[model samples]
Target: MEEQVNVPQIFATDPKLFRFLTKVIHDQGLTPGVEWKVCEGSSRGDNFIAVIKQVVHVAEGGTALNLLVKSAPRNAARRDAFGIREQFLNEIDVYEKAIPRLKSLVGFDLPVADLYGATSSHGEETILLADLKELGFCMADRRQGLSKEQCAAVLRALAQLHAASFALREGSPEEFAALAESVREMFWTQPRRHAFEPFMRNANKETLRLIREYYGSADCDNEYSRAFRQISDLGYDFLANIVTKVPENKKVLLHGDCWTNNLLFKTNDDGFVSAKLLDFQLARISAPMIDLIFFLFTSTKPKNVGNYLEEFLRVYYEEFERRLKTAGFTAAKLYPESELLADWIACVPYGLVVAGILAPALYCPDECLPNLESVKENSREAFVNEYGKVMRANTPESKEHLGQLVKLCVEREWLRILN
Candidate 1:
């Protein structure tokens, strides 16, 4: 799947993909009277879950429209192990149902990519979206993480989204509950745990190993070891229950995966970095702290995190409060600043677990990324375990990512309860 796949080669391998792309174009009223071809849209490490390609269209006088189309996985092993179809359906459901409803409820436009159409027909699942690159946006270098300005931009965007979820929840409880029902918990569900358990256990073990290596004595029944062990021991139900069993007062739909790559940025006319959210595959109903903590750990410069962690909290809270206030709800009564901070402290373990999962995708350069589809292995567990081994090869970038987060957590006493 990582090989150089030309248009003809792609169509030859997956014949029906072309038809689906064409149908999306026709239905979306895009590239009227133009020929189109599928071409590479992103590099290998930029995206992993979907087969992404650009539907490049050109007319007689060179009028062009370049849109991005994401389809299902091509490999059966990857498809089944990752439950690509289920995630695709979840993502499509968010775009088709949740986004529009949220927009209407919030009375403002969210910063998501403009989706043209989505479909899950026969053997093909695809979503057509206007390309952000075509609109003067690009990804920051993952190794460096987002700058303070970029992070503030992302946090502000996240606040608006979390606020919108709160608005929907308060204004229409039944409707909000219905929307929550449609979002399938893609990551930590029972049926898919068989496939994800090996990955999770191995990932947790690797992180614990790194913790011991970094601090040299963080093992031996210490908090660091206990934290990762708790996650690995509890596994699926532990993680799933944190999300699916949320209290009514603590509920808000989370952008469950908010790693660096899932966000795109451009400097607006106001000369500030602004972000557009991407990837709803992991969208689920949960508290806002999960999203906030995950992004802060995995996507911000670790140095900035230790120094400006409270600043980040303030930025998000002020915006969240503003949005809630506008909707005739008092943020103090609904979710006070003290409670948000306390909840955020408690959610650090969740952040740590998810940040380990994000490390490979966040820090692995295109040159270092492996093609999971082509890996030779006996079963999903073996493949996932091997993948963890490869990803945790004592690479400086990833080790620093883990080390800095752990250090910050320790300094803040966020991991103290693990003991």
Candidate 2:
């Protein structure tokens, strides 16, 4: 592993993990004598699964280099609580196996941060990735929400990733099967799902409480309470099944979690140039609409949705079709418009269920978030009791957006919440 004494104190904290990071620079054609330093990669609450560290290095004569290192939590209690290891391994598998095959199909068109290296075994996991910020890409404000223009960019970027999945699968079924089999579903497994069940149910309860405090207060009629009561009855497994058990030939390796924060945008003098997808921790092979619904409702500004939801869908469709045909693949026939709509309708239920957790955290203030970098500081089990209480209070943005999403889903008939 490059002599341990030469390693920076920040990285030297974890020798095995450092071994993986050092190999990354070497593979990139760097000399052993290169200078390197480490610093906090992201702000608090911005990342949870791993402690993100940015390693900046300067070669003897060439340009300086900055890269991100995602190191797994070493504490077993913190790591296993929410299946953090499985999620990290799933992401590692995607970078090592799936992304390369798909990138070969789409060339350099796929808009994910460059993958340098990934390693995980016997509970120590780490992945080295390109820092998108170094490439001038920045995330949108999760609280203020994304504008129509920004949303269009993300949809187009998502379209490219989704399209590549189609080209690979249709062009070579065996390769696609191998790729799919390698990626583990982050949620909905036996022990993990069971562990997550109570947390999810409580998040739902918190949603109802927030709704009562926000929307319910403004309404003359008790719509929020009545709606979620029906939601509470539908049960958890039903929603999980709709997301996990897609009828064959209808799923893709989704970014799995596509909120505003994970979708980064790059702009030039003229305008927005590109968007890069980030954080593959929850990456899973699931229905395409799950990603769509997750991004639109949970991550978007409440004002941009409701009656205007179809505009974003149109944006996704046009770009996706253009990409598929350009790749020498068939047009809309690959995913018939009718079937796409059906799949979308089926996915809304899963979206509603996930919003309970994603929505609250979407706009939570920094102080409200649990300190994830320190193991004992905020263990998942300890935080589970009060998932959305970020610093003991819910932000208005989270509550308002979540409530609006429910109303919009009902209005569009995308979901059925009996009242």
Candidate 3:
């Protein structure tokens, strides 16, 4: 006879969900006495995540298993409001379909959280996963970028991810196509575009204001100024079309949103030993540089970029090539270093746009954080209003970071590449 366990209210309120989660545990070969607790700092956006601690009592006392449960928010209105239901579905596809296929490649280890089970209906979704924290994973500070070693580790992980996609596409085209077709381009969805246009316009205006203040009208004829002017004037159109364009040859499955907040790192006495990518809600099929440039600009310090940008690029390229060859493909024939650099240079303007818009928010004081709820209610107006407040509250450090970014673009001749 087995003992009956009382599930806590955190997961017990819904009997169906409780039974589903219990089955998840049992399928993992765990006994049924389970306890649930809300994960600290896990309730955000459209999901609520909890940790399940299962203790099985037997003749030899007991054993324990800890798992994570992420589900749609209980509030029906809020869950329905943001119009991000498809994004959740896309994330589920990544974990349930994409990761498994990628992991099948020889010698490839997917640097993402392990999934136990996933379920969705209508606009609601739930995903149960192995708790990475239980495996000694911790997030890097969002305010501070990764150290050199940490950056290298992340780049290596990204290389494996990208290479695995290439291998899948070559070895199992049908399977790869099926998974890729399921990924939705959430960032470019009509509602998101409506919200993004006004935000881009405001960001362009602010970026130009800063540039003029720093370089003055006399310098407008210079190459850097001319490029900036052209890009800024195009504004929303440039952002909408060019930034989202997929490259013909160098395309791969992109992490899409690779900002610091979505990455977790594990460190030991030597330094960062491993990294895990998270938050696949924005995953898409696009140029690999889209992920590379986005991660470089948003998650790294200006000084770090200045010192090691090329080195970092090389690391990613080398590792990508290594994995490709290991999977029995010719990297040079498929994705040479020259092609990769050319793709990266062509994407610099996109990086500038993202950095410009994200800087103010990324650096805004805690008190000045935008009311995301209000933004969801009225995206265009609320975003523009919040953009003003963010720019007003921007710190000198952030301003300098933006300035350095532009300077680097000029020095690297990224503008020249565009022309």
Candidate 4:
């Protein structure tokens, strides 16, 4: 057996549990001697993640094998400040249920390492998973905006995902609803609703500053500022109403947080090839159209957005309807294609509230360029230049998308002055 090096402090403090965890690994069919190593995950405030790596040797004595060992924070006492219960644990439960259902349906191209369940002598839960890089996957580049072709790829993928979830719900209503109810602690809690209020207040101020900076000094009553204000005021209302507004008796698993960062891309030796969905931390059962609308507004580039918008809607409707039929619902009774966009448009304010945050806040000072420096320059003009990227309407693609969106808003009498 290879001697283990000094593992990180995360494992160092719990030597006895480490030994027990390794023993469970041996029970999985490896020999008695497997070395454990430490792995790291990005920090989320006070709570942190660590992985245990165990090198396994077959008892029959041929080749050595590598295995990933993981545990949620074993410290039950450590759960107070970070809101870990509502976020992290909720994700694990949802993924455990959803992954099996998803695999049984479409069988995704994205890689999933192994999932092994473990428990401490005290009954705490630990999970061992296969690492993605070992299966040849890496995170996607955020700097490269989603290309038109890439947009098509993700749209098709979303269709399958939406279809599968809808089918599952329709085919096994009680079981699906039970699973959704199981994870409702994260989505339907009062905390999340409260969390949004403060976040929205801050977001509203940031968006207004962004809009004024992008568009020139028009009176506060001018069309541009008026439009900005209209949406900003209604932001929370739109978010709160999505569940009520969606088609009655229809709910699908929604990737509640469907931004570019959460949707990872996979590439081959050639270039960008496919995308993988990630961060199920906020996944929930909501309107299917919510995911589609979120992806279009928040992730796609302003310019290419217009051309692809209709195409995407058409694709999603066809797929959703097809899957509904496969799962045994009539087209007329289930999800109607014509109603999809109307449903989508009704959800536009929610989209704008989400899109308004991406450009300025999403990218770090490093990945997003030109404007990154502008924000630091701290001049009124620089701020305007940075904000105008979203507000002033730069490319023909953007103008097309925004124009349609504005027209929709006008029809709804939303942000009414923008009309």
Question: After superposition, which runs of candidate 3 have C-alpha atoms over 4 Å from their true positions?
Answer: 1-3, 12-16, 41-61, 74-77, 189-192, 209-229, 240-244, 370-393, 417-419
Please report the candidate that would top TM-score against the real structure: 2
Best by lDDT: 1
Query: Which ranges in model 1 have alpha carbons more than 4 Å from their true place?
Result: 1-15, 28-38, 59-63, 217-240, 325-328, 365-367, 373-390
**TM-score list, all predictions:** 0.88, 0.91, 0.84, 0.71
Tens-digit per-residue lDDT, 1-419, candidate 4: 87453344555777765565556556667554434344443221111222234433333354344454544444343323224444555556656776677557543422234455434233234555555545565554443457775666566666666667666676677767777786653433455666456656666565555555445442334454467577777656556666544554567777676666665456678775565565555677778777777777766665565566778777666755665566556655666677776777666766776665554433333332233222455444454455334333333333333334444455455443234
Look at candidate 2 and tell me the lDDT of residue 216.
49
Model 1 collision count? 0
TM-score result, candidate 1: 0.88
lDDT order of candidates, top first: 1, 2, 3, 4
Of candidates 2 and 1, the better by TM-score: 2
Kindly give the stretch of ten consecutive residues in candidate 4 with the minimal lDDT sum: 42-51
- lDDT: the better of candidates 2 and 4: 2
